[model samples]
Target: MKNINNIFLYSALFLSFSVFAQQGKQKKADTLFNKFSFVKASKVYQELIQNNYNKDYATRKIADCYALLRDPRNANRYYKSVVKQENVPVEYYYKYAQSLRGMKKYKESEIWLQRYIDSGGAPGNNDFTKNVNFISSVFGAKQQYFLDKVRFNSKFSDFGAFEHDGKVYFASSRDEGVSTKRLYGWNAQPFLDIYVAKAGTRKNVDHTAKVPGEINSIYHDGPVTITKDGKTMYFSRNNFTKGFEIKDNKGLTNMKIYRAHLVDGSWTNIEDLPINGDDFSTQHAALNSDDSKLYFTSDRPGTYGGSDIWVANINEDGSITDVENMGNLVNTQSAEGFPFINAEGVLFFSSDGHIGLGLMDIFATIKGDDNAIVDIINLGIPINSSTDDFAFTMNPNGVTGYFASNRRGGRGSDDIYAFHREPVLHVEGVVTNAINMTPIEHTKITLYDENDKEIAFMHTDENGYYQINIDRNKDYKIVASQNKYIEDYRKFTSKNLQTELITIPTNLLLNPVHDVAKLAELKDIYFDYDSHEIREDAAKELLKIIYLMLYDYPDMVIKIESHTDSRGSLSYNDKLSIDRANATYNYLIRGGIDPSRITAHEGFGSRQLTNGCESDTDCEEADHQLNRRTHFTVVQME
Candidate 1:
């Protein structure tokens, strides 16, 4: 009886100790997670899961950690287990959907997205649910940017490229020569620090060095913005002051934006902005064009989501006031941050909440005349991928700039990329009659490359206006043709242009082909020197006669006459002119004009010089070329 009692007591003691240890581990894991130390928290949760203690809660926590770390593959795996449980949180479905999308499993993603909606998740929160063809639309968006990874990126998460005073500033976790190499538990990388490099044009960077100032801290620092005068600076950092961290009641140190002044070329006197709070984070500071208003990302009170963009007016005395949230047009029920407003008052930010390709895609705001955000536009591919992309900044010109992304094939977990906005090359114009300046409706306008290959074609509207998009840095020829009219040709080049939208005003004027007298007054169709082959310029003129004969007057009969300059021998010139006439006749035959419509073809050679340039030396080269011409006369119209 004594041995039995002893055995029972020992077993009871051991069971109590095991339960106590498990409870302690759970408390520690919860604390780490609440503090945003996801990496450390995830390990603790996994240990609990392996021991079969609080398996459900640990599993869900691990999934959340992976999601925050942007490890979508691992997140998807863990979330699979989480969603199979009974009475799962509605957010789990949304998160699972996002993880699936990050893996490009779009179909499965859509199913979970629907589940989220069915489980009382707000449809407005999921942009994918609003548009039925959202995926296809995002993939089919035109690529308007060219991206290249910056050369100065380190192997340890470098991002947030900003420009100030001829230097490029960015945040990095590189700890090659730093004194304190403390790593963040969230990523296992060293805390971010601000670094500067000499800026070069279009994605070039020189030697990089740490900013020689007291701005960087032992905790997270950097991703900064400066005023245009280079005096005032705002940067994100941990809520630490005087070598000690300040924490909220939950013992979490939130991010805060600090302001510093440039005195004698070194930043000093750093102070936290008034809008910072002890509980929620307020970081990623940006300024409007004139520095009159400061914009930043925050999760403070009145936020509609995990984070939202907020603005505050910068008073004349350097005090910030009138804090306002940037409404639903710019915010959603997901993380949104890294706001950058260009000189043109255009807002560019990053969000996973908006309809996008996948995980945090860059977005731009479309504002009304009153400067209110009316719509949000996703800046599709190259600027955004299936992973996190944010921290977009543009130069004053707005054509070339830099942004950060964590997509595959980067030097770091998150790398900064330089991008150049491809110019929207287009030519728009009105087609009008040369004689009366009247709009010529139904004229077919065609665009050809330098090689005379037809690339695009359109017809003039009722108002005689036409527009055609063309490739950049190439020569293009545009032809406007209509029945009963002479074709008008215009040639232009889009080389050495840097504007985002290059609109070339190309007004075409066509002459009416009323009668033989009107046709005779048309510009001479000149041929190349010493060649009887039809030149491109001559072919354009020949097309007009073809159109008139084939479409305008099907029963019209025309006579062709060719002439040559005086440089060639009379017999050779006569033979060359006859060959030119034959070439014109063949061209018309191929253009769908009936062969019976031709009345006669002849060669006048040098005998029909339109100018006094009987010899090459008598006039300029242009005048001599005028004699080498072809003329079409309407013999009969029915």
Candidate 2:
């Protein structure tokens, strides 16, 4: 019964607003129509004309607002309206034509644009008209425009998109929630849980939630952030387990900031934020542009409104210092929630209190000293509809941004949507053989970080093509290899690699290793001078030799031979190289090789490598590596 009255009240309010609008009278409304308020202001001008008032300037003001607002819908409406009521300003008619062109009424817009130029419309004022003409002439309407939609089945609504260490961290109210039971006292749902998933997985949906079992009790447990190493997770969980003082009458566990350490890839020992904190709801967290400080929303005391956005200093220990309310420029008497700081230090938050297009649309303003805002900007349509759109978080590079929306045609209640920040990098390329430029099949393309861990890997199809989706300023290595080809390695240097339609195509020429013996030429055996003590390098070579012999001829037993130069006495050389062979034999025995399959050493002494010994004065060190050697020749075939 009481809900009926509230619905009636909203309906009446909407009707009243449609019936009347006063020009520049509302204090806050005048403030928000900042630069583009021309559309609403133009409506007021139209009202004055309807009232039979002498307001020729108001008509032009309407056109000006439409021009600045960039809304072809209303821009065309008032453009025609102003011309019908008054002689279209020779200067304004070109803008009207531009508006028409924006609406795709190109023929009509073109006719008016000509008259506008003939009537002495200045080039500067008609810049918008010229841009419209270029769009129609140069790039036709059929030019591709894409709308990327993310559809996923979520247990609970998802929000707070953060990418750390190449994986996406987000908060989801899912069936796999931390709390299986709901809270009866506050009538709160047990859905708000934290979840993580691979960022760009388009196949079979995986909604596996990775929340610590202990911290995610039967309460609100999410809206989380993860450290770069994924070792520390900072999340907002309701109620303290030890029972700290909670000022909010709702519930003690309703809102609090908590941190937990990730040991062995699992979260442990959850703790609450210490400084600049209260029992009140300290929820809705946002990291600063540098991620040095965190901005969160709370309805605690000392705030001018229902909820105030506060900034807290982030400590190395994951503790935060006394939080300061962003002040009047950032907060208002109305609910101000969901703070987001972009790379430019511009502050973005959502509020119905601030004069805006609708309830809960995002707004941006330069954060100034004394909490004063400079040039507050309202996010335009689609991004900002008459519905709730909040909880925006972007990665460090700022090329791709994410926001939560229940907007429509989604898999679940409130699935998260990702968007390309204008000028996002769309990196695409191809891989080919360096020699012939022909497509190489089955070539593996792996992308790795500085730590040499593979982030993504793929095999080239018949065309030998590979594409990588990457952010800006990150160092990455592209290694391309095929079954028999030497790997083709290349590196893409860091530049302004941030754009949505970026095309950086390259070829990966993989050189095939046709020379089989040249493979791993580093595999060598070396011996000590005048001694048969098998060096560790030589031992390793013998080990490989044993492995290959066993692999290729499973039933073969071979004798290992060690040789020395003529400088040594035959008897001395015999014992020296024999001990060398025996040392290698011992190594093989220690390596789990069969003792039964072995034969003793055969050292031929100085006769083995005395190719020039009969007349030689001396031999270089290079000859030494060759002279002191170990070899395996198959002796007995089992």
Candidate 3:
């Protein structure tokens, strides 16, 4: 899952073997391997394997070499041969899994993942166990994105997409000139260089041009970050100056962050960051939303892992201070880098340590109210793969974003992909009382899908309002409940609309069963023609009465009053309306409303008509329908 930054290929340490008696050729191969010359080391190791001398160790070493070179084909072949051996390290299983993933063998990769876990890899990390299940769930989830290759991608590695000031800036290894053609040993690709292109539709994107000569160095210089105003810029480059490279204790030159100021429509006054160090790398710089803290990936001392995300405070004078590791919440024993924080404070980064679908899956971390990382969620499929998927950036809206990956179907090595998240509908509303329309605070609300399956739950705030996200083209049943009030229910649907935001004006008005007149305020329940059964629409309204009597005031008594129109004969109307009232009483009892609470069932035969139509059609159909209705009143409180 390592980003193939060829300029600093020495950062990847070669695997060591136990010293033993060997021939001259084997000794020379070990020498090359120790010097971190994986390309030469692999050749010698292969020769030993061909001769059946030190076959086991040589096979392992060659596999490691191919892996270091990012050659998945050879790595997979060699790993498959020896990975099943009992003496093989647990890491071999992981490497084999990554290799399979690189080849788009997802199911086979999953088998190796199980082997890695069974071999005690990352013991006691429950997140690793959950990650296996999370990957499966991700594949079955509704597709949330539509991906397309970015137009500016080159045949070489092109990634790290960022937008600022009407231009898109990214890192590319595309050839510029013969002078800038130094090759990186890892993938044998030219060193990365920052390129700026007009940011627009594919048809209008200007051919990408290299940045000013001051920014483009012979070594790696790319993956830039800009302030909100697009004035200040920070980019990654090898720690070299004046035609000489800075080497650490391991004889490896590390990457460093550099600052550049925008002046007169060009980047000028370029300088190295104050935090640069020779012992470790500090690259992939990013600024928080308010520019208060600068976030970057570093392999410095005191790191909890190979590479950790560190943050430094940006003071008023623009000097950085108080650099601290983001801690284990974001870092692990494995490499984690390419940190990007959006305006919403959600941190997105790539990691191999966290259990993921593949090698380096992108993860999102959101902090809780206490500023602790509440959840570290893997951004699953299409955004992540078994291959290296890092260097993610997005616009303010978050509907569209870009990330780089070496997964299959790419235009070339590590192609940059543009993706847009499908719109997720938001449901927002206020919970208020029906009588005085007063805000109901702290009301528990549960959201369920059409099949009555619960989706999510929340409590109404002090302002009597709540909001939650729901999927589009789905029907939801929202149930609002409070201890002292009658519960309310609403049926809502997203209806296949792809709008950015959708608000449902659901106001739950609960009538207290203690007040008889207030209970009567509920709309009259109507029955079908010549039938006493509660229709579907009328049953929904009846749920309020049932909830009030059963939940709010279990012992409170209520009377069911069924009225009949003036059309039927007096005796028949009386008998029919009585049966109708009894039917409603039975429905409530079946719904778990206490039958004891229903104190009375009475039918009035055409006696309480407001239209005053006696045995004649003097009133319109609307008036007659109103006369044939059911009403409930509280007969007792407490």
Candidate 4:
């Protein structure tokens, strides 16, 4: 009887072991699913579903895997089982909607999207309304951009297109003859590396060559941004630097931004950026045309969501400081990345948080005068789709640009697409001295768009010539400044009048600083309530005076008469006015004007009032503002 009982126990134990072995296989599937290796993960998930092991989870994952793999037919088949399943997450509804859309089932997609909103998904967030509007916008609006896939796409993921020095640079996972190429388990693709090729038009492209060892690494290395001069390069890479590695939570190495100098036709002097931290990731480095500010994506602390776009001020010494978040207007409770600022200050980035067609969509926003995000709107269809679309960039001409999209009908996982817009506007002109009418070489010319936002700035070539791209149906302000001359300002608009490119040529004739008081009336220099610091606009005006003393009229001498409104005691006003005058004097010296050029900075203490805003009487703020003025007079010019 004891032997028979033992035999029964052994049989039960064997059955339990068999069940545990099957569960292990399911766990492995979950691992793969988490890593987004859907191609491999779906096999195990489907097997588990067939065997009725965790059938609900397995079914949902199988559907999701197919959706991510862009196999909408299979995704639709599998999703049908869980789209209406009980207690599923709201994201399932969104995913189901996208899969339906990809399968060309618009009605079904809208139904799922409505269900998702009704289930309290992304409520109170413009998300629901944006998605619904996107449907109508896609069909109602005319497509403004035509996209064509480039010729260099391999059968693997390729993206992050940028153009520099007449060469096309991008990131790719193609086998680039690197023996050390290792597969990233996350997607089972080779690690990304930077590649360069000859510049090509939309129709033709040359084969690519891998960057040198100085830039490429054993790990991911690319998606680089080069300065307008192509001398400095900023790129993204893992934290493996100088034999050290930085890792974040879960022991995963995070990405960091690095800078390289173009030394003797090769990239050298690689250094990790100061904004990078080991605890998070920083990638996608982009620069404004001037290279004074670097914009990038990071998952660092203080981010609004999984990631946010941030900018760092690049100092004259080549060090970066003052990292700033792009703020709530641009970032949201989801990820935002791949920021590209065109020659115009308009910012273009990809975000999953904002209302969009699908998983991720491209959006554009203009920076406020304070350098903060002011407005944001989706780029709409063709430029955006029901899948990931990012890495947007434009040529200096603005009309021609490239972006990466993983939407259906792509040649690879992610392919670079060239886009062209019609009715392009171009601005070309020259800068010259107003007195002599001679070309002013190296003069700085700045262009501002309708919103009074800077689009771009450039130093005039040898002939004081410059050309830039501008958008039609918008107002623009062009300012020209050169050493030894007063800045020139002009305002104009492009009405999209012609089919071909329209060139608006306006030559700038800058005046000498000593002649600013004669040529253009100097405006009142305003300060914060009680602070003596000069305002930004005021500083720009003051630079005109500095230019005269320092460059144009090196022997010029000037006297400053600072005045204040009669709001305080006479003694207090006198001291305050003196402080203001000293502040302006310091500004000129700091701006490189010789101290000896200034004869005197007298504080009038409200004695010289432009209007009657006396301390003893009630007056409007505007009246007081007029009284607070700094008058400049040329004492001598040689």
* C-alpha-based local distance difference test score of model 2: 0.59
RMSD (CA, Å), each prediction: 27.8, 26.0, 23.1, 28.3
Q: Is candidate 2 or candidate 4 better by lDDT?
A: 4
Top-scoring candidate (lDDT) = 1
Residue-by-residue lDDT tens digits, candidate 1, 588-627: 7877667788887788878888878776466788888888
- Across 97-161, the per-residue lDDT of candidate 4 in tens digits comes to 76677777888888987887898766333243343432222222234566755788877888899
Q: How far is candidate 3 from the true structure (C-alpha RMSD, Å)?
A: 23.1
- Using all chains and alpha carbons, the TM-scores for the candidates as numbered come to 0.52, 0.44, 0.49, 0.46
Cα displacement (Å) at residue 347, model 1: 3.4
* Candidate 2 lowest-lDDT run of ten: 135-144
Candidate 4, pairs of clashing residues: 484-552
In angstroms, give how far residue 238 of model 4 lies from its true place: 0.7
- Arranged by lDDT, best first: 1, 4, 3, 2
TM-score: model 3 vs. ground truth: 0.49
